[model samples]
Target: MEVDHLFEIGDKIVYPMHGAGVIKAIEEKEIQGKTQQYFIMVFPVRKLQLMLPIAKMDDSGMRLVLNMTAIEKVMDMFRQGEIDRSLTYKQRYKINTDKMKTGKTQDGAEVIRDLMLVKKEKALNSNEKMMLREAMQFLISELELSNSMTEMQAADLLNDRLNVEKDAG
Candidate 1:
């Protein structure tokens, strides 16, 4: 398997389990007398730091942000709003968690889709609601940064595609 250099120092990247983080530094260090390179990433929101070995980057499933075309596809799915809502919460949660673990941008988008479907059905539990908010925030921030749009504008675009009227009484 080829390992693509998907991140650079000072760049922001998203960890599937950790959400978004900035690459604080890249360093060569000796581990057990062997030289290894690592990307030091810090998650400001979680106050967490991760030292990811470069050799394991692909195994770790790290990836660059989705391109504009991919984002448009995800938005189309959101607009379609055709996800099955009959699945039990546990089943839905497992599916979303698996998607997150895959660390693919499309999987992340699927998480957003599932959460939005849950919300629209008024089927989200408290924990699920919190997870949904985090997932949406993470996805929106990356999309906004990648596409050079404001966070609010990005969110509004998604809402509009989903035909969700904000502040509708």
Candidate 2:
């Protein structure tokens, strides 16, 4: 149960199933008679605050946003357009969900690319649509932070790079 202490206040981090957010504070709270450190994170997009136990940082899939060089690589992933659309929707959903849970920039891009391909051929069900939105948001938020781009700029950049629809709503 070793937690990697890599984050500090003001550091931008990404949480799996969540999005990019800033660490607002660090505090210790006693729970069940044991005191532990936590990172207080504020997600502006979601308008949510989270107190993540420091001891569970790695286990929780929290990670620093990619650096600029890494982000460049992620952008390249979008250009390849190598989506595997052969799987059934259920199978694709499961695979995409697993990728999203990894909270990696490239994985998120892959999900967006795959789903956008699916959407172009046919409309997605509500669940798939939601998943596409979330994954795109996750990717965009990280790009915004890591690249110091505005949200609109990031969205436009991604749209141009991936050649996908703009309806990430």
- Which candidate has the top score in TM-score? 2
Per-residue lDDT tens digits of candidate 1, residues 10-92? 88677777766678998888888988889998866566899999988878866666767877876565544456757778888
Candidate 2: which stretches are off by over 4 Å?
A: 1-4, 82-85, 164-169
Counting clashing residue pairs in each candidate, in order, gives 0, 0
Every model's TM-score: 0.74, 0.86
Top model number, lDDT = 2
Local error of candidate 1 at residue 162 (angstroms): 3.6
The local distance difference test score of model 1 is 0.72
- Lowest summed lDDT across 10 adjacent residues in model 1 is found at 160-169
> Clashes in model 2: which pairs?
none
Candidate 2 residue 56 C-alpha distance from true site, Å: 0.7
